[model samples]
Target: MSFLRSLSPLRAWRDLRRFLALRKPHEIGFMVISFAVTGTILFALYKDAAIPPTYKRDVLYVESWPLSRTDREIIDQQKADLIAEKKRAAELRARQLKRQAEFKRLDDRLERLGI
Candidate 1:
């Protein structure tokens, strides 16, 4: 039964031919152009898919002094300076808050004395 059903290539081809024959000329032209464009795009992509490997020099030489203890010390000093600046900023904020509180107290005292 399945073999008989599978042997329908003639019917399929006939249906396909009938469908194509019924299609308008403009519709057929557009379909052909779309297929050609898709095929060309796929071919272009397949052709350019490979990347060539690159070569590099195996030997290297130093013309100047590499990183030393002094470089590390300089980096450490910069980090310490940043930390100190942050601490100074925090202290200044605390001082400003204290000054604001003192000013509020003075204003209250002056208002109480009516002066």
Candidate 2:
């Protein structure tokens, strides 16, 4: 069929050679510019039309308690959670401070060594 024949690399190469041999430089430049502009427009349109991805990363997972739990239990759980969060934050701050101190010491030693 015509479609299969058009798919031949040899035929396509010959056509390209023929076009280059026959066309003016300005004609080729215009064709190249036209193709580039048309391609960019089509790509933009395709991107806009395509469906976006749904991400589970946007959903924040939180702890769920039983509906049968009393108000006092809920309050206690909240307090415990807050305490745990604070402890974690404190630990992170301590780690960061320790790292900063170590880096400062290393910098001082390096400076003494003229490095």
Candidate 3:
């Protein structure tokens, strides 16, 4: 798109520089330290030498994204609870329909008696 093409890399860099210039010295130092730490962690994660050949990269990456064996167990338990809840809901719905039918029968009897 023409709009996307209009975005200049130099302009973005200049904007970023201006934004950084507005920050206090302590804030800038904190930002730099955080960036360094994050970059180091990412570099370590993706660097081929840091990974063992036996482990697939996808498995290694997925293992770190906040879900482990205990989490899986919890998820499975929740799914089971959900299924039980659905079954209970269906039972309640059937009871409700039966009650509604009984009420309609009573209403029809009252109409026939002119009450």
By TM-score, the better pick of 2 and 3 is: 2
Model 2 misses residue 16 by how many Å?
A: 46
Order candidates by lDDT, high to low: 2, 1, 3
TM-score of 1: 0.40
Runs in model 2 lying further than 4 Å from the true structure: 1-64
Global Cα lDDT for candidate 2: 0.88
Worst 10 residues of 2 by lDDT: 51-60
Q: Which is superior by TM-score, 1 or 2? A: 2
- TM-score list, all predictions: 0.40, 0.41, 0.40
Candidate 3, residues 60-97, lDDT tens digits: the string is 23333335558778789789979988997898789889
Tens digits of per-residue lDDT, candidate 2, 4-105, equal: 876988888999899798989999999999999999999999998896753334455787778899999989988998998899789878988998999999
Q: Rate the local accuracy (lDDT) of all candidates.
A: 0.86, 0.88, 0.85
Q: Give the TM-score of candidate 3.
A: 0.40
Lowest-sum lDDT 10-residue window in model 3: 55-64
